[model samples]
Target: MSEANTALSDERIKNTSRLRTALIRPELGGICGTIIVFALFLIFAGDSGMFNSQGVMNWSIVSAQFMIIAVGACMLMIAGEFDLSVGSMIGFAGMMIAIFTVTLEWPVWQAILVTFALCIAIGALSGYIVVRTGLPSFIVTLAFLFILRGFTIYLPQLIERRTIIGGIDDAAEGDWLAGLFGGKIFGGLFQWLGDNGIIATFERGTRAGDPVVDGIPMLIVWAIGLVIVGHFILVRTRFGNWIFAAGGDAQAARYTGVPVNRVKILMFMFTAFCATVFATCQVMEFGSAGADRGLLKEFEAIIAVVIGGALLTGGYGSVIGAALGALIFGVVQQGLFFAGVESSLFRVFLGLILLFAVILNTYIRRLITGER
Candidate 1:
C-alpha cells in the first residue's frame, strides 16, 4: 500500500511540474496569439500576395522596426515605468542628426555621435526628474512627449526656415558611416541564386538580371540583435532579478538592497536609447528627416508590450513576447492591405486586440497565482 501511494505521488508531481513549466512562460500568450493571427490571415489572404517574398519583406520590415522600440518598452514596463516621449524622441533625434550634418556641415559620423549623446542626456534627465520628484513616469514622460514634439517641429523651422529637413542624402553620399548604417548585406547569395535560376526574376530585372532580393535590411538586423540581447539581459542576469523585484514591489526591493531607483532610472535611459536607434535607422534609410516622423509610435510600442503579456501594473513580461506582438502588428497591417480592407480601420483592430490581450493576461495571471 505504501509503494502504491508513492507511485501515485510521483505521477502527480510530474503532472504538476509540466503545468508549472507551461504557466511560467510569459511568451506563451504571445506565441498562441501569433499563431492564431497568422493562421487567420493565411486563410483569408492566402490567395493574395500576402505570403509572397516581397509581401513578407514588407511586413517583416515594419515588424522589425516596431520590435526595435517594443523591446525596450517591454523592459521599461517590466521595471514599472512608461515613456510616452519615445515617438517624439524619434522625431527629435532624426531632426537633430539632419541638422547637425546638413545645416552645420558636420561629418555624418560626428553628427551621429552628437545626436546619440544628446539622446542619452535627454533620457537621463527624464529619469532623474521621475526619480527625484517621485512623480509617476507616465506624467513626466507625457510632458516630455509634448516638449519634444514641439521642439522637433519648432527647431527646424527656427534654423532651416522649414519644417522638413532635407539634404541628408547629399551629405551622406559616399560616406562609409552611412553605408554601415543603411547598406544591405547578403547580395552575393541572392545574386548567385538569381544567376543559377533558383529564384524567379522580376519582369524588369536589373542590368545584371539578378533577383530583387535587395539583401537584408540593416533595420531588420538591428531588431533581431537587440531582441536577443534584451532577452539575455532579462532572463540570464542578476540585474534582471533586480528589475523584477523593483517593479514587483519598490519598497520591498529597496529594503533588500536592490537599488530600485537606479534600476528604474537605467530603464528609462534604455528606453530613450532604443528610440534613438529607431530614429537613426529611419534617417539613414530615407536620407531625410521631418517633424512628423514616428508619430503615435509610443502607443504602438505599449500595445505590443501589453499584447506580449506584460502587466500594466508591472513586473511580469517577456521580451520575446513583445517581438511576437510586433510581428502580429506587422502581419495585420500588411494583411489588411492585401485583403482589400480599408487602412483607416486598422485602429479599430488594434483597439480590439489590446482589449483582448489585457483580459487574457489578467486571466493568465489569476491562473498562475491560483487566485479565485
Candidate 2:
C-alpha cells in the first residue's frame, strides 16, 4: 500500500512539472522568433554590411520605433483594451508640432509641450468614453482613428495649403527641448572607435576619417527607457497586479476594489503618450512631418504585442517579450532590403506570424483554464 502511494505521488509531481512548462511556453515564442530572425538575416545578409555599425544602427533605430509603441500596446492589451488610434495619434501629433512651430511661429519647446498635452487629453477622452459608455475599446478607438487622421490631413491643408509641412528643423535650431528628441548620444565613443580603426571611416573628402556611424539616436534611448519602466511596473507593483486583475475579470476586480475603470483610463493615456513620443522623435529626425506619416503603425504595434505573447483575452504578457517582438520586426524589415528580397513580402510575414501567435495564445489559455 505504501509503495503504491509513492508511485501515485511521483506521477502527480511529474504532471505538475509538465503543467508549469506548458504555462510558460507561449511567452517563449517572441524570444524564439527573434533568434530565428537574427540567424536567418546573418546568414543571408552577413556580407551585405547588415551587421556593420551603420547597418546595425539602421535596424536598431527601426526596432526602437516599433518598441516605443509596442510597450504601450502591450500594457494596454494586458489590461484588456485596445488603442487603434495610436498611428493616427502619431501623425496628428507630428503635424501639430510642425504647425505650432513653423506656421504659428511658436517656440519649439512650447509647441512640443502643447502637442503632448493635447494628445494625452485626447487619450483620456477616448478612455472616458469607453468606461462611461461600456463600449468596446476597439470600436471607440477605431472611431478616433478616422477622426484624428482626417484632422491630420485637413489641418495642414487648411493652414499651410499643403499636406506636408517643412521648416521644422529651421524653427527648432538651438532649441533646448528639441535636443532631447533630436540629439544623439555617445558621439565621442563612436569617434574614438573610428579613430582607432574600429569602425569604418570615410576615406575621402573634407569629412575623411569620420566614423560611418556617429552615435546612438535619442529614439533608441527612449525605447530602452520605456521598456525598462514598463517592465518594472508590470512585474513589480501593486498597480501592476491591479492591471492584470482589471483585465482578467473586471467584475471580480471591482468586487475587490481594484478600480478597474481608473486603470483602463490611465493605460489609454499612456498609450497616447507613447505614440506622441514616437511622433516627436520621427519628426525631429526627418525635419518634417506629413499627413501620411505613421500609416498602419497601429496594426504593427498590435502585431508586435501579440507576438510578444499577450493573450487576446488579456491578463497575460511580458514587456520583455514585446521588446523582442519589436526587435524581430526591425531585423526582418531591414534584413529584406539588405538581402535583396521584395519589400512587400513583409506584410505576408506579419499576417502569418500574427495568426500563429493567436493560435498559440489560445492553446495556452485553454491549458491554464483546464479547458478542452
Worst 10 residues of 2 by lDDT: 7-16
Candidate 2 local accuracy as lDDT? 0.93
TM-score of 2: 0.95
lDDT tens string, model 2, 51-89?
A: 999899999999999999999999999999999999999
Q: Using alpha carbons, what is the TM-score of model 1?
A: 0.93
The lDDT per prediction is 0.89, 0.93
Off by over 4 Å in 1: 1-21, 205-208
Q: Which candidate ranks first by lDDT, i.e. highest? A: 2
lDDT of 1 by residue, 59-167 (tens): 9999999999999899999999899999999999999999999899999988987898898789889989998899999999999999999999999999999988888
Root-mean-square deviation of Cα positions for candidate 1 versus the true structure, in angstroms: 3.2
Q: How many residue pairs clash in each candidate?
A: 0, 0
